[model samples]
Target chain A: GAGVSQTPSNKVTEKGKYVELRCDPISGHTALYWYRQSLGQGPEFLIYFQGTGAADDSGLPNDRFFAVRPEGSVSTLKIQRTERGDSAVYLCASSLMPNSPLHFGNGTRLTVT
Target chain B: GESVGLHLPTLSVQEGDNSIINCAYSNSASDYFIWYKQESGKGPQFIIDIRSNMDKRQGQRVTVLLNKTVKHLSLQIAATQPGDSAVYFCAEKGLDGATNKLIFGTGTLLAVQP
Candidate 1:
């Protein structure tokens, strides 16, 4: 694709439910990142991947949040036992290489009711 | 833990006027910086980028100035337009050997009144 793409533009789930957000980055991009944006705030880094491995996952809020880039192209962010505080926009970005300008997707808005 | 912050939370400028948004970063070791514009219901768009080696960089209607000495960065928009109304954010990239990670700052909402 020409730009980064995210699935389920909007998702509403009950508290404690499991939810997954998918992201498809631009072709051949070696770096992918996941971020969470709360209302009235900037996007906060969640995790970063270089190729198929997660080079940085320190930003994940807790053990309930996890992400994977299995094929180095498509990525998934899984949230277990989602809480009401998890209601926010999940953003995905891809870069040609590390430190390069990131191209962001429209993001998936997750509402944990 | 490194963090970036913005000095102003909101800025309003008249159409065709020049606008400047400021940011402060605590990490001095960061090597790369970028400016992004995000409108409501949309993702952030890359504006311009600058390296620590350069003090300033200019793009079409945008300019980024970095001051490592004071740990400050600013984005200047020339001839601001109504279409340019959006939230602007500054991000810093810290290099870990061959890898780099971006750390973003609190954003400033820019409203260009026509």
Candidate 2:
């Protein structure tokens, strides 16, 4: 079975720019999540979506970060006015349901210079 | 605040030897715990998961032991192999109205010596 897939394995942008990371969840997964991992640290929760609606967005650091899953499967994480502090690997994961074990994709590493 | 932490930053073991990784969590209300293995430049992969009600759970060559009384978690790998070398992290599911969120620990790197 196909696992969760993320596009643009690596992205480099200038500060104050905007970038979008894409995630394609598993065929039937009903839940999708986004996390950020800094150097030498564990992944930090960012946002989560159930079906087409975001179930939880509290983990999002600020208003600059926003995510959407319009068709209920493909998701996009958008960052506005990126900062060097935002440099990190952005991970995407999906599960069959809310409580199911999540399957992760080889995240998209974003670097803001 | 929900925080899960590891006891060791790194663990080195000989191939074929048993390996043990320990973790401690702060939220006693957490009922679900999971172990994940992450290789360099790759995302985390699920190893095993256990509920608070169970003290121990076993998989192919891995076992997870949980001590709720002390808020401790341990992962044991029997006959460790080089392929098992990677960073191991224990994550606890938060109960603060964000059930889908998982609080992860600062991972423990496992290096298998041949």
Runs of candidate 1 exceeding 4 Å displacement: B1-8
- What does the lDDT read for residue A71 in candidate 2? 93
Docking class of 1: medium
Query: Compared to the true structure, candidate 1 yields what TM-score?
Result: 0.94
Compose the digit string of candidate 2's lDDT tens values, residues A44-102. 99999999999989999999999999999999999999999999999999999898888
* Each model's lDDT: 0.90, 0.94
Candidate 1 residue-wise lDDT, A15-113, digit = tens: 999999999999999999999988767789999999999998888999999999888999999999999999999999999988679999999999999
Q: Which 10 successive residues of model 2 chain B have the least lDDT summed?
A: B1-10
Per-residue CA lDDT of candidate 1, range B1-114, in tens? Answer: 322333448999999999999999878888788998999888899999998989999999988999999999999999999999999989987766544567888799999999
